[model samples]
Target: MKHFLIIAHKAHTADDFSLNDLPGSAGRMDILCRCVNSALFLSHDLRRDVQIHLLLLGEPDPGRVIKFDGETVRYLNPDERSSGSLIKKALDKDSSDFEIRSTPGVTVRDANLSTLLSEFKQQGCSLYYLLEDGKEIREETLPRGDMVFILGDHNGVTEEEEAEIEKAGAIKLNIGPISLHSDHCITILHNELDRREKEY
Candidate 1:
């Protein structure tokens, strides 16, 4: 199964509240990119040969993008439905093993989307908290296999989105940055990543 990374908030996840009137589509593209970059770096460091791709499928230029090693970022235009349609098409076209990698900050918001994207994969879509500095990613500390889902925030999700995911048989998770010291968000992030790693 091919893997796709869809992150919603590079910085938003840590905020006490959601951003107001932000361009919803593009706001989390950076979160998505960071997700891929973190996972790619983790795979590389661990010498895992899991090839992945990044598809920026949406409107308004499909958002501006930047590239990191071992990842490709592109903007895709899906007929009228945007991401939902485009991802469905990609699933049919690829017709191979695939899974989606996302961060809770984004994936949880649209759990139905996560459910749809998982259909094409041998394993279900996996989500993670990508915590790193600009220079490196620490994957050994990340949760693996089925444990990724539990690394999400315990509260604050909207009722509508939560209902959809719960109805879909997927569990909601969150990783809180609020409890950590400013210089230690990444530290707490690493610990949280490790916590799940061992939980499984």
Candidate 2:
């Protein structure tokens, strides 16, 4: 499976944020919504082997992880507003360390990046940190097994967070020299993976 973990550094963690203004009131949640769409959507259907996790660290409350499993997800559209609505519903529910399902194939939980990384490690997922200064992704042999890519939203991941991820054994990779939006990066990564798969 392909896993994407996006660090939404300033995305609002509460449902009270206005969906109508996801870019402002939701604290740049629109970026995350677009990431979700890019991660799972295809020309006519969703990618069943993909899952996207949004790590929200914003005001009022923080450290909420929203996961969308494309295998069984329903009611997810290609539009940003529709994805935002699903995210809002997940935030409305009470969350604990245990995941609570807000919609089909979507779950919410109270967890931090470190804990999630540990879990992914335990699951034998090959972790890759996406950054512009890192090694070019095409230079490495992409793993055929379960793999997870870590990326950040507009503001990008902080130095401390990058340290933690590297300490957890995530390999740093870059698509190109120029920095791109997190959502755009995902789309490019997916295309690369698709081409690789077709070659095999």
User: What does the lDDT read for residue 73 in candidate 1?
Assistant: 25
Task: Please give the TM-score that candidate 2 achieves against the real structure.
Answer: 0.98
Give the lDDT of residue 47 in candidate 2: 99
lDDT: worst 10-residue window of model 1: 103-112
Error of 1 at 60 (Å): 5.4
Report the number of the highest-TM-score candidate: 2
Query: Which parts of model 1 have CA positions greater than 4 angstroms off?
Result: 1-28, 42-57, 60-159, 177-200
Tens digits of per-residue lDDT, candidate 1, 41-100, equal: 432242132223333333322321121222232232211233322222332221122333
Q: Quote each prediction's TM-score.
A: 0.35, 0.98
Highest lDDT: give the candidate number. 2
lDDT per model vs. reference:
0.31, 0.94
lDDT of 2 by residue, 1-200 (tens): 99999999899999999878999999999999999999999999999999999999998689999999999999999999999999999999996889999999999999999999999999999999998888888878998999999999898899999999999999989998788999999998998899999999
